[model samples]
Target chain A: MLNKVVIILTSILLYKVGGKLSLRSQLLKGILEGCILSIINIQPAYGYELSVKLQQFGLSDVSEGSIYPILLRLQKEKLIIGEMRASESGPKRKYYKLTEKGQEALQLFTHHWTLIKGPVDNIIEQGGKTDGSN
Target chain B: MEATEIIELNNEKRTRLTEHNLKYYEDMLLYIRLNGNKSEQQTEEVLLEMLEHLLQAQEEGKTAEEVFGDDPKAYCKEVVEEIPTEKRKNQASLIMMVILQFLGFFAGSYGILGTALHYFFDIGSALTTFSIGSGLVILGIDLLLLGAFILAILKWIKQSTFSKKEIKSWVEFLQVWAISTAFIGLIVVIHFVMPSFGKEVSIPTYYLAILGVIFYVLSFLMRRKQNF
Candidate 1:
């Protein structure tokens, strides 16, 4: 009886949780990923450079693990390229440069965000509630 | 110090850079290597330039540990990743739930293809059975897929890095991709077996089958990359 009750409650809780994870969380991801894209436009950079610039822009939780993989994916997608060299310290140093594909992707992403941002703002302004913008 | 000696000393820990300083060295190394200058003097100049930038970054007032948030130049990912929702869905158990559900959608639907085949052969009458059975099975898979998709979303809601919402959207995207491929598979089945029945099979059916095979391989690669 206890196990049955627990399963029902758990399922209900899970459903409630799942339903809420929608546009907001992904939009946040888009913003951060887009920021990474825009930065790539300025100059080729490394993971640390990205992390640093992101923090300067008021992003606090960015980690090297997340950024490195995104860089790798961007490189794999032909959106970016990695330039590796032997460092004086002995570790291989990799720099990330934006490809034409990356530039095009960034442009499209920025445009999409602009379109979404307006309605999102209107919705939030309708109520003082926000989907965790900070 | 001689170039070789300097490198040896640096390696031996005489020039041990703190984690704080290490990333600076890396960036300068990347800069010098990429900017078409690799002479010792140019390397040294780039290193100094990077070191200065690192110090300047600090003077802007951010701690090393919270640099993702505090540093003016850190990646915004630190901010996005810190979202509380992403953390919950990243758990092995939850990720497993999504993987199982994702696989279950197709695994549960495999029988549909077989049923469709049995009816296609006798097409004189098996048509009713195949149409009815395939439709029902597709319905069940759709429901399961929908339930799991929504569940994946809810699971990722709060965390920044892998918020349940992102998971939900990704699952939804994957499902759409999966269903379309299943239809393509159905078309492929029709091409080989249907051609034997003397009906003119369309050319696009063959083309779609080819595309389906390519996408199947690509999907496998994507799944592997995601560790799904």
Candidate 2:
């Protein structure tokens, strides 16, 4: 029991340390998926609306400087396509929609995420206790 | 929190964001705005988030008195840091290649002068013209060999993204080689070939050899640096 307790504490410590280390990667992964899902959950989106949604997930690193590169990369990869639509605000805004490939990728990503989330949520709900093995 | 409530975002604050990292910050904003379920109660939530970032900057010991402190370029630089560096070596290589070709052209001219000097000048005028012609040929060849040095420097400059010192070193290295080659050529001609054929075939034979060496050296360097 004592050894188990010690193991749990060490694992939690590692989790805390690692969370800080992988903050950017985690934030980017979360926001990227969230954006993709937002479009799938809806249809298409412009830059402004997507930017607002990314912030709500506690990701502050998604500045305009950071996000545009990812968008460009997605376009380059042929995962998404964009078209310009006139906005009530001022100029036309670029509205992006998932490509066929993007939709396929989103489906796979969702399936894998669901699989990974199960054990993860199990641990979270059980307060990190498991069946005597890692 | 009502759906009817509207909020105004300060255009000046929003316009301040820019980066050459292919619109990184823009993507970030767009992602948040589209995905965030912020209600109208959070009407200016998007703008407020950005405002909070600026406010946090002050809390972190940023200047309180200043309204907007950092320049747009400074923020742009930060964004650029997030992206990969551009391909610059190919550009530098092309520039160096052009310069090398020019040097080869000059070297070819020197060879022409060496051949001409042997024919045009008697022993009296031959010595001076011969020396100058030989020197320039070697100088041209030296420029060719130095092209390799330019490649190395270009590699260094591309990796560091600053300092053109490597280029300067290449130029100086080539200059030294040119001078040295000229001196050696003069010595070889005067000692061996200058004494033969009653001074008729004398200057031409040795001058040709020296020009040949210079051309050979240059050609070797040029072939090595084909810019491929």
lDDT of 2 by residue, B1-228 (tens): 211221234344444443321133343333333311222222233233334344444445533123122243343333233233224664454445556455455545655675566677732333323344545455555555555555455443333332224456677678657655765565455444432222222243444446555655665575466423
Worst 10-residue stretch by lDDT in candidate 2 chain B?
B34-43
Best by lDDT: 1
Deviation in angstroms for B150 in model 1?
A: 41
Least well predicted 10-residue stretch by lDDT in candidate 1 chain A: A7-16
The lDDT values for all models are 0.47, 0.46
TM per prediction: 0.32, 0.36
Model 2 lDDT tens row, A1-134: 44445444434422333543254444444447546554634667765456555656655454532444455445556677756566566544457788888877677666655655575555566653544555
Q: Please write out the lDDT profile of model 1 over residues B1-228, one tens digit for every residue.
A: 223433443444414445754553443233233321123322332233233334444566533333322332233322222222223333443344444544444433443443455556632322222244444455455555555555444333312232214346677678667656665565455434431222223232223334444544555665565443
Residue-pair clashes per candidate = 38, 35
Q: Candidate 2: which stretches are off by over 4 Å?
A: A1-34, A37-49, A61-69, A82-95, A128-134, B1-228
Q: How far is candidate 2 from the true structure (C-alpha RMSD, Å)?
A: 15.9
TM-score of predicted model 2?
0.36
